[model samples]
Target: MLDLAWRPRAHLDRESIAIHLGLERKAPQAALDAMRRIDDAIERVRTFPDSGGRVRLDALRRTEYRTVLANPYTVYYRFDEKTLTVYRILHQCQNIDTYALVDLPR
Candidate 1:
């Protein structure tokens, strides 16, 4: 069987989710639903990053050390032969550049 890995960025992504959940004015059900979608999306990538290089999640794209879904947030990572190293997570709304996320350790 193939191995699965998550870049450290996934941790930050989870933290970001926590913050979103903490928002006081949002509907609980809708927040939970979105969280579930985000969680499911990441897990889906773990199970199948590509079907021979075609993405399991068609909505994401690879950047230098990061992967961006349709805005809102991004996932940074590095892929080795058998493992993926997550670097950091950020909200696209931050108005920052890639270097801002470089502070994350491998």
Candidate 2:
């Protein structure tokens, strides 16, 4: 399995999602479940790096982005021989355009 690396934005995204679910929506258990699901998706990615569906970005066609769903959220990442780097964790409702993934490493 490749080593895992999380971008700072990805961490922030996760925290934001948890906060929104737990504090804003008053759904602590749902937040916890979402976190668990996200973790499970990450583990799946670690074990099978190519399991995620490819994401197409017009601006960066040369760079491949992949995604794994965690119910209402999605985990976006890229992987190489030695590492799998998670770039973002976003809500399913969000518009996932190039701008939303601007923080991804080139």
Candidate 3:
């Protein structure tokens, strides 16, 4: 298995989701469940790096951008021989191509 790494935006995104669900929506249990699901998706990706579906964005087509769905959210990542780098964790309703792909290293 490749080593796992998280980009800063990925961390912030996860934290923001937790805050929004737990504090803003007053759904602390839901927040925890969401977090667990995200973690589970990450683990699944770690075990099978190519298991995620390839992202279908024109600009990202040349690169191996992939996503693992976690119900209402998605985990976006790119993997090399030695590492799997998480780029972002975003809500399913968001325009991921516009939001997550920006500022990512090609």
Candidate 4:
């Protein structure tokens, strides 16, 4: 089993989602669901990113930050060996870097 732990970056994701919720009614369900799928995807990705099963972020330099989109929303997750961290959750148009936090050994 994967040992998952979310860092401060995850909170940024929550805040991003909140912003969307405030702007519209019915909440960001599609985004929320995408995040959930991402959580599940992390396990497999943790095992392998080149599995052709998940979308990998190629613009972030040498980072593991990647997102899976559900319509206008994007679910962001980070994988660290045994831990698959559910970091950021946001819409496709959201400024992804604004929520970006580099990883350091904890």
Scored by CA lDDT, what does every candidate get?
0.51, 0.89, 0.89, 0.57
Which tens-of-lDDT digit does each residue in 22-106 have in candidate 2? 9999999999999999999999999998999888666656678899999988999999999999999988898787776666453
> Between candidates 1 and 4, which one is better according to TM-score?
1
lDDT string, candidate 4, 1-106, tens digits: 5566666656666555655554454567755665566555555655664342243445664665666554455656666556666665565676766326554345
How far off is residue 105 in model 2, in Å?
A: 11
TM-score of 2: 0.90
Worst 10 residues of 3 by lDDT: 97-106
Runs of candidate 1 with Cα error greater than 4 angstroms are 1-10, 50-64, 68-71, 103-106
| Best-matching candidate per TM-score | 3
Superposed model 4: Cα runs more than 4 Å off: 15-59, 102-106
Clashing pairs in model 3? none
lDDT of 3 by residue, 1-106 (tens): 7899998889889999999999999999999999999999999998899999998888777888899999999899999999999998888888866555555553
User: In candidate 4, which residue pairs clash?
Assistant: 3-83
lDDT of 1: 0.51
Residue 9 C-alpha lDDT in model 4:
59
